[model samples]
Target: MLLLLIFGIVLLPKASTLKCYECSSDASGSCKDTEKQCPSNGYQCAALRVTSYAGASKVSDINVKSCAVAEQCVEGSLNFGVSRTVITSKCCTSDLCNTQLAPAPAKSTPNGKKCFRCDGQTCSGTLNCEGSEDRCMTTTVDVAGEKITMKGCASKVMCVGSETAQLPGGIGVGLSCCQGDFCNSAISTRAGLLLRVAPLVTWVMFS
Candidate 1:
């Protein structure tokens, strides 16, 4: 019985192991077909595609597939006038489930919800929210010592999820989401933005 118990314990870990495809590409335009074993902490295999648009012209597309945390499987879009980024991610638990490539995100039609957006140094323009984008979002990130801010419409998955909490930046970035029209118009200074905004995001999630 003791030998059998030890054998079962050893087999249990192997039973939970998953194999996933792992590759990333931007300019190459395709992900290489490479297989990898998922780490013990990884719960799912994911395929992701990111499409970038400048005005009405498509600029670039990125594809990635790998072992992913369950929380990173959310699919969403963010439109910021001059540039728009859309991400589509599919997740599965079975081994090699991410072998299929994620499809390109489709463009969405206007849905009547409006929010403030930025254009260069100006943040007074309005953006029409589309599809599942029912929330207004403001993101401030420090890039190479320069503060960059963007405001736009965002999907609910982008606002309230483990994905947002895991965004790059220990405490230097500020991200806020609100439901009302143009509610993301005003943001605090860089020094206090992250501190003040993180708590406010919880209220937005519940409201």
Candidate 2:
């Protein structure tokens, strides 16, 4: 029994650890950084990019390379008429595999789906849902002690559990998702415009 216990303890650690590139940049381009050991087991090397747009003009683009869990390997987007944020990622299981930055999200046209979005006081404005944006979402997050709510179109991937935990400051967000046109109703708020044009970095999309 004593020999069995010792053998089990000796084999507790992994035979080989995973290493990945670590770069957290808010700059609007590719970034490269030195490799580092993954924080823990069950991690993958990941390269992620997030881009923000004001109407049709691009506003900012950010990139990150680091260790990520399987759940963080997804891609999603949030589109409000006046503003939008698209997240794209590439993940690999080997060491130092996150060398290249993630590519930009593809251009998607309106998919004929419609959802309500907030711009000013009332959240009654209609927004055209785009490519893969088959779901309507409404999110309320606390920022600077004030509760801010924003409604718009989103992909189903963004509604999955814990996948979007890093966006919009990572604070607890009251989120609701549904399918069909105008399924997400408007919630009146004072921070409508504040959220419509909020910067992506200010939301801390990457840790």
Candidate 3:
């Protein structure tokens, strides 16, 4: 049981990349004057572009839209076949001298893109989660059938218990072992108080 409990703690699912969005730009023609910020303000150097994919395949003429800060433009680019698409026609703020032109539109095939599983339509996440906290928690999970033993200096007494739960998919089981020192201390203190009162009550009744 102890071995199985330890195993569960060591094995949990870790989040990983199931799919990724590919972006590109087309740096061809010259530019004149474009808005460098969002017309609504509070957003500097914002841009949006539409790219039409055209080719001789099942994944032909796929239109993609992307936007980013003009000062910090993050466009996507990928070279699949012969055609090198371009990303153009962006909306920016009034900061022309600071905003660099958006990257060229490019051709990107959603080879591993997943279809939306919604009521009407299903779409993958448009933006990536880089600094997400959930990603950090998943990274700490360990593999199944691994042994991990950590020794810590516990204070007071130790109240030990074990809990087990069914793993996802019902493929296996999981266990969580917990030892609380505060609980043990509380139990001991209550027992001492009860013992002290028991003798006094017995003596009063007998006298």
User: What TM-score do all the candidates reach, one by one?
Assistant: 0.78, 0.82, 0.21
Off by over 4 Å in 1: 160-164, 167-173, 186-207
* Separate clash counts for every candidate: 0, 0, 26
lDDT of 3 by residue, 1-207 (tens): 999987776553222111111133234323233232222323333232323222232222222222333322233221111111222334443333323443444433343222111011211112111111011000011224432211111111110221101111111022111233211111111121221121110100000
Give residue 22's lDDT in candidate 1 (0 to 100): 87
lDDT of 3 at 81: 19
- Candidate 1, residues 99-196, lDDT tens digits: the string is 88788887689989899876534676788987778888887755457676767788776664436454222211254788988998744333323222
TM-score of 2: 0.82
Sort the candidates on TM-score, descending order: 2, 1, 3
Across 40-110, the per-residue lDDT of candidate 2 in tens digits comes to 78888888887888878888887888888887787877776767778889999998988899998899999
Candidate number with greatest TM-score: 2
TM-score of 3: 0.21
179 Cα displacement, candidate 3 (Å)? 40
